[model samples]
Target: MGSVGTRFPTPAVSITKHPATLPRSPIDDDIDKERVAAAVLPQLLDLTAADLTDNAIWRDSLALTGTFRTFFSRELVANTWRHLCKKSTIQELSITAGSAQILRFGPEACWLQASFSFRTQGTFPSVCSGTLGLVPHGYSWKIWLITTILEQPLGFPDVDKLEPGPADTDHPGCLDCIVIGAGLAGLDLAGRLKSMGLSYMVLEKSVEVGDVWSKNRYDSVKMHTSRDYNQLPGLPKTFTKEDYPYYLGSEDLARGFKSYVKTFGINVTTSTRVDAATYDAASKTWTISAEREGTALQMSARHLVLATGSMGTRPVTPSYMNHGKYQGHAMHSICWKNAKPWKGKRGVVIGSANSAHDIIADMVSEGFTSVTLVQRSKTWVLPASTFGALVDPVFNPDTPSEVSDRILLGNPLPIQRLIAMEGIRACADKIPEYFERLEAQGFKTERYGDLWGILCDREGGHFFDVGSGELIAEGKVKVKSNALPLAYTESGLSFEDGTELDADVIVFATGYKGDMKENAKRILGEEVGENLEEFWQCDQEGEIRGAWRDTGHPALWYTGHGYAHARYYSRFLAMRIKADVEGRPIPQWSGSC
Candidate 1:
């Protein structure tokens, strides 16, 4: 079924058959589907739909249903919320996506909700709602974020015995701040707001925490930025080993978030998403709405924060013949579940970034017949450990072998120089597209945008890190580039160079389009995001503080909004956003400020 196609009768159900019952089936059977569906649906926890548009309510009920998500979960939001006159009584509070009707909840409970929908698969649609549940236990307080996905039979979202509060915003209780995207920046901002004793809510869009890390499971998804610099403030790692750098893997980082959540008692809604935000100047608030799983919900808050961060959704995929027709498994590095499935089978990996390099190495090391890497371009690779083979030297007796050996290995100067050259070569592998585009658009030329571009602009130097490219091209590892892939077939992969190799799996490592444009559109309007020349000019001038809209929309802020570079940008972004919190003076360095 498509957006609208095959329609299963109300309360969809399946009938079990009894063997040798053809005669019985021939007779007319008047059955009550309602009763049967009711009995069967509840027994099953999973409520799946091929396409929700196939339902009658999809068109009309979709929006209304989304608005109803406020009943799914509750969260103990932390931010700058207060009234001017006296010490804020409700200092550091929580907001729950109380039951759909706010009046049903108690006065102490703050009602809030958000519901969202996504295509789990081409044929499957998913919908879920998140609610901030409110409950009281002695003098202490706790808010729970709950979510319920829509079922085929539409079982009502579980409601608490105590009545939830109604959606009434005209009272003394009102949000002073709202922040979206529960990533690094959001968490930091939330912590700051909490410290400042302001009421604020942070919204995130995934089933779990750690926005980028949780969404991307690529094999080589390690932090490229130096761990010494990357650690979030307050999340310090002082002990060091003999190794030059310590690796911070996913598990390590996830643990840090859990600890932070507990230590700060930060309220967060896992498996939730913020879909829409409407700024109401008249009320000095933003009508924030979202979808948790598939249900709907809304909230009101002042001083909106769009911390959706960078790297939006998945990268754009190119059209290829038999992309879906291929019999073998095909997936993006972002969706690489595990190397287990591709084991013992030939794999054709694609891409040139760290992910492609890491995944190909992983696949080959496993039991695959061969792992052929199909890269889009050449790239730099930085190894965590020592790189390549080592050499040993011996000397004459008169010269004392020890003496010759010391001469060869003694001075760290020679080894360091060699390492430096190798590192420079690695840095040279970056794509020249940026330089070419710069030239086309009129930038200082003769020197490319690789290392030289960094010299030109200190602020943008992080984009081109030296020494990463040489390791991959030094021939110490397996790889293929200089030629692009032509097409994917049932047997294997065919590159544009007439090279073909049998492959059992194909993974596209294609990169993501640095698109803050859509976000800019929301911040500004269609004219900025759609009109090309206008966009370029606007961005050239308007993006005063890296990604700000250079001109209009003074009070808003978008943290970590530029292209991929050193992760330091995130910390810098946090500092910038910290300045924007209401009542804080404008940041001195910011052009707008």
Candidate 2:
């Protein structure tokens, strides 16, 4: 791989950094708020079917809808909108009945929430509801993000309602491939394999297909990326900008996965957990032992795909923290479902990553007595709204999703890091005050080399700021950085700084061992786990070490992390697996042969 800043072909334009300009006047007043709300409907309608090339509303201001995980640029938004419109006819769009509420009334920017119901052309007619994010601009407001969800699935198929039991465990059968964890990556690989007419069975430990999303029923546990970037392969856009426009919540995302399985007739074995796998190089096959409802079953397959995504398995809690001594409740953020019991109770959340910040914010919003965030180290913070504007625009909707994915992923890791670093700088320069206020609150924020360095190069080290930054900045959520919990006291947590904080509940958002090393040991035995090179970490060539590529183990593959990654890379994985099964000579992958 080349060094950082190596010239590479990217769709991104010139980089510019400047703080977000605020309109001289305020727009949160009663009259202005109402005025902005009234004006927003027409502007939103204009973006749906009409030409947005010179639309007056978004011409001066960008519409940052949840087209993707982050902000979708005005141009990409236009392209996506046009494409969706071309596919479906607008049956109905109703905004008059919906109510608008102010989310934030900050001097720098105001966030507003509003909902609208619409029906468009599809095999199904569903009433979709969307939450709009608007910012004050002069006397009016500019719409930034719209998070849409299917409110009523009128025409959408209810696959879960259909009668289908778990995988047939009575019979032990051998197949070509066995995919573990029916998440985005597993489903994607299964879809690709099915298209190739390959025989396979997806084993999901959970009861549902997208159990990661289904089981994690947190209040605001939505995907970090945009819908466009997180799509499954070979599916008619079930979640295009025109229909499901918002960042997907747990239920909706699960529903999408269930729908995909039904649509593709993808063979999946739910409620089945693989206990162990042993490979036979002589036969080039793996014998798997799995349990479903306490029944031990054995099966065999030529290829084993570890699709149990980066964060799917266990939550990492600091073994140092004396949980036994603490009288309060303690849990990982992944298990957080509702904030009901801890409504008026004081809470201490460990770590300052995305889940930590989200849990803190949710607690604060739920009227917790006080929620303090414990930051063990400095984290790179980027406004989630800037994602589309700075990073996602490079992935234009006009380009095929597969092509765009290849272009982005095929680049040298250092170049990607440089691009991410450039975006982070541009964002910081664009909203210096956002960082200024965060710094004022005793939070030390800095980009760690670049965003990709944290996202791709490393396991995890950043928080995508949505609204949590404000909570921390305004002192709504307390922070304790560079502090480790030495021990837990009866009342609260005692840190290394010799300070104690009273807490009713302690939530550890401390993250997990995403490399699935422990999982490898548990599933593939100690010897296999020990021999399997570390997965997810970037190699010297800036490529992922053992995932989606070669892991040196015969007929074994690992993949998980992002949706676009699964959507595009599944093809390559499928091709390799198919080639091996077809007795084709396997060529060298990636490096110079």
State TM-scores per candidate. Answer: 0.51, 0.68
Give the alpha carbon lDDT tens digit for every residue of 31-118 in model 2: 4444456567566545642322221111100111111112134455555554444444445655544367664312333455465556
Candidate 1 lDDT over 407-499, as tens digits, reads: 322212112133333434443334354334433422222221222112112222122222323323332233555466677777866667887
Number of backbone-clashing residue pairs for each candidate, in the order shown: 57, 8
Q: What's the alpha carbon RMSD for model 1?
A: 29.1
Alpha-carbon error at 278 in model 2, in Å? Answer: 3.0
Q: In angstroms, how far off is 194's CA in candidate 2?
A: 1.5
Write down the lDDT that model 1 would get: 0.38
Question: Candidate 1: where is the Cα deviation over 4 Å?
Answer: 1-172, 211-216, 235-245, 293-296, 322-325, 381-477, 519-551, 561-593
Error of 2 at 308 (Å): 1.8
The number of clashing residue pairs in model 2 is 8
TM for candidate 1 is 0.51
